[model samples]
Target: MPRLFQVIGRQEPVATVSMTVYLHATSADYAAVGDDYLLVDSRGARGGRGFYDQHATIWSRDGRLLVTTQQVVWYRVTK
Candidate 1:
């Protein structure tokens, strides 16, 4: 089984952006009975002039990696 996620809220304008994501588990990982799991997100930003990059990773309670993601955004400057 596959899960779907939706985000609903106010919309904001953004410049050019790129992103990559890796999901490292199947439904079985989530459907297991009597199993407790943990999720963690790590993020960072670098650069100036409204340009930055960020990354995040999700791990289980036992330090098993579940998912990883990265994204970059930058604005165009006009002279």
Candidate 2:
């Protein structure tokens, strides 16, 4: 599970546009800070795990992540 993030939603078409992301619900407690693989349909719905070792989705000319993924990693804490 990923613990730290700012899920912004991809709202524009640019080299790197600001994204608008909503918070994952209170399901798991750790989100790995790596690329989380994602899958989207023609309707613009994303489907995939929320955390991973590394994720980098390529973007298409239509402003959709070429693939569904972003970098994320498991949260590590020390006391």
Candidate 3:
């Protein structure tokens, strides 16, 4: 998502060689009135291979699943 990019870009400056892709949304639930939610994200990078991935999930305050996302990123290696 564009918003995600904006947030990430603001937090840290990413290298020009890297790329990010939103793979898919595994689940999503509509929030009801006066409902609170939480966003949890987990990410990992492969050892200097220019490959990275991220998994993000949104959960309701009551611990119910709201949404989940899968993302993959790649970077160009230069000698």
Candidate 4:
């Protein structure tokens, strides 16, 4: 299994917001394969005169990374 950690947290909404992630994990046994690495995921939102962002990282079994994904979502709120 992989280990996941949240590097960022949600904040207030604003005009614009950005989230960044850095994958820097290493493994000895798993690192033997090229598919070994760290996976980072990030998300953010802007609304209500503020913005919020969050990030998460997941490593594969033996602390290796083989799969990766990215998702961006936007929503408009009327208040």
The most accurate candidate by TM-score is 1
Tens digit of per-residue lDDT, candidate 3, span 1-78: 423354345432224334444423343444251455465655553424554565666655666665566655554433
Q: What is the lDDT of residue 40 in candidate 3?
A: 64
Candidate 1 per-residue lDDT over residues 1-79, each given as its tens digit: 0000011133333454788989887767645422676776755557556566768887777676777988776644342
Best by lDDT: 1
List candidate 1 segments past 4 Å from native: 1-16, 33-37, 75-79
TM-score of each: 0.56, 0.19, 0.46, 0.32
Q: Candidates' lDDT values, in order?
A: 0.59, 0.33, 0.48, 0.38
Residue 25 shift from truth in candidate 2, angstroms: 30
Candidate 1, position 36, lDDT: 79
What tens digits encode model 2's per-residue C-alpha lDDT throughout 1-79?
1212323322222121223333442323213323554343322234234322443344333344344444333332221
Q: Considering only N, C-alpha and C atoms within 3 Å, which residue pairs clash in candidate 4?
A: 12-51, 13-49, 13-50, 13-51, 14-50, 14-51, 37-65, 60-64
Instruction: Give one clash count per candidate, in the order shown.
Output: 0, 28, 0, 8
Ranking by TM-score: 1, 3, 4, 2
TM-score, candidate 1, is 0.56
Task: Write out the backbone clash pairs for model 3.
Answer: none
Q: Residues 1-79, candidate 4: write the lDDT tens digits.
A: 1111121233322332333444444455345655645454534332222233333556664655434333232333333
**Alpha-carbon shift of residue 68 in model 3 (angstroms):** 1.3
Off by over 4 Å in 3: 1-29, 33-35, 45-47, 76-79
Between candidates 1 and 2, the one scoring higher on lDDT is 1
Q: Model 3, poorest ten-residue lDDT window?
A: 10-19
